[model samples]
Target: MKATIRWAGDVKFEAESGSGHTVTIDGPPDHGGKNQGVRPMELMLLGVGGCSSFDVMHILKKSRQDVTGCVAEVEAERVDEVPAVFKSIHLHFIVTGRALKEAQVKRAVELSAEKYCSASIMLGKAGVDITHSYEIHEAAE
Candidate 1:
């Protein structure tokens, strides 16, 4: 996995992944940026969310759950000190399916946080205090 970030002038950058995808990143207006795109920290949070969400959906599919939709909402807290590192992170998943089993959803979330999701594991190892919860909704007929 490789990516390149090029400075696009005044606290802005264009990042291109090895897979030929691109994203624009910029700082806030108070930080000499035009706020043209997502902040770097926000991207980090999204990465974790995406990684975990993918794992949950994959696990559910493998378990033969009639999954229809999955959404992950990620929230984080940062320290006020220098570096402003993540203090805590939480992921709330809304899972929709036909008669989704609570135990299956719970186990999937546990597996992602404890074993599968690389992003969450990395942050937890670095003392980020990651946590997760999920809600299962019955799919409409």
Candidate 2:
């Protein structure tokens, strides 16, 4: 619910979440940064993937799906302007399981995108052109 960001040096910042977790945000050397950590924009996009992945896993578990692994791969585009804000973002989920029902997997993804994932939903509401897609793979024996 709360967080703080402090300057760690030139073009670098450290963010501490309310839960006491910390992460470093830095830019490329061309931007006067040492490139010691993730960029702020990358972190923001990752947050959306994390939020959506959490929701999908939770829903699948609740439904008793035999989940083996899950990965949310994120991609984005930024406008070619001074601010360079995100213009669109896409999430491609690769879900693995044993005998995973296609309908259930589809439903889980839809639920996360439409109802549960707060980060993506918030960005969507802010006109960020958010989109989602998914593929299911059976676990290896």
Candidate 3:
């Protein structure tokens, strides 16, 4: 569970994970960055989204739900003061499958937010207002 970030110049960095994954991070031009890649805060939000989405899909699979596709759309707000931090975060999951049970979808989302997703739990403990919701769409035969 480790990563390294190297300064690439002008508010830009190369981030490498312990698992051999890499990403480029940079700020916008207004912040002295070239806008070369995703902002660091944006990456954090994405990490949270990916973490919770993984949990949701796993839970649904374990419950024998016929899930075919899933996407999590995350939105967050940050404080305007110095040392700005996330004030609120919302995750909207759109899950697609054939005859997906509404109860199953609801339960999976609840389980991820309340139990399985470590990222969400960590943010929750840090006083971030994390909320979850979902929509289930049946695939056409």
Candidate 4:
């Protein structure tokens, strides 16, 4: 729950989580940065995707679904003014499994978006429009 951000230079930073993981954050070249790493907003979008994906996978596993792989594609829009913030966010999940039940997958996605994904829910409550969708793919034989 704790993290530290150290200035690396103009528009660049090194962020270390309490767990000891680190990431480089920087702005684009035009923004006085060399584009060395992910932007802060990009990281936020990824966080939302990660949180929701974790819930979806956990729920599907506990339900005994034969999942083989999964991917969460996150997209977001920002307000067009100073202190620009997230205007909307969308998560598209691609799930692959063997004989995966559509109902089960749908349930998992719904559960994550409506109940389990804290990050997305928090953003939603903050007036950011949030949405979710999913697709299923059969594993190759």
Segments in model 2 whose C-alpha atoms lie over 4 Å from true places? none
Residues 18-65, candidate 4: write the lDDT tens digits.
999999999999999999999999999999999999999999999999
- For model 2, what is the C-alpha lDDT against the true structure? 0.94
Write candidate 3's Cα lDDT for 1-141 as tens digits.
999999999899999999999999999999999989999889989999999999999999999999999999999999999878999999999999998999999999999999989988999999999999999898877
- TM-score of model 3 vs. true structure: 0.97
Off by over 4 Å in 3: none
Q: Against the true structure, candidate 4 has what lDDT?
A: 0.96
* Candidate 1 Cα errors over 4 Å, as ranges: none
Pairs that collide in candidate 1 are none
TM-score of each: 0.98, 0.97, 0.97, 0.98
Q: Give me the displacement of residue 80 in model 2, in angstroms.
A: 0.9
Q: How far is candidate 4 from the true structure (C-alpha RMSD, Å)?
A: 0.7
Report lDDT per candidate. 0.97, 0.94, 0.94, 0.96
RMSD of each: 0.6, 0.8, 0.8, 0.7
Candidate 2 global TM-score = 0.97
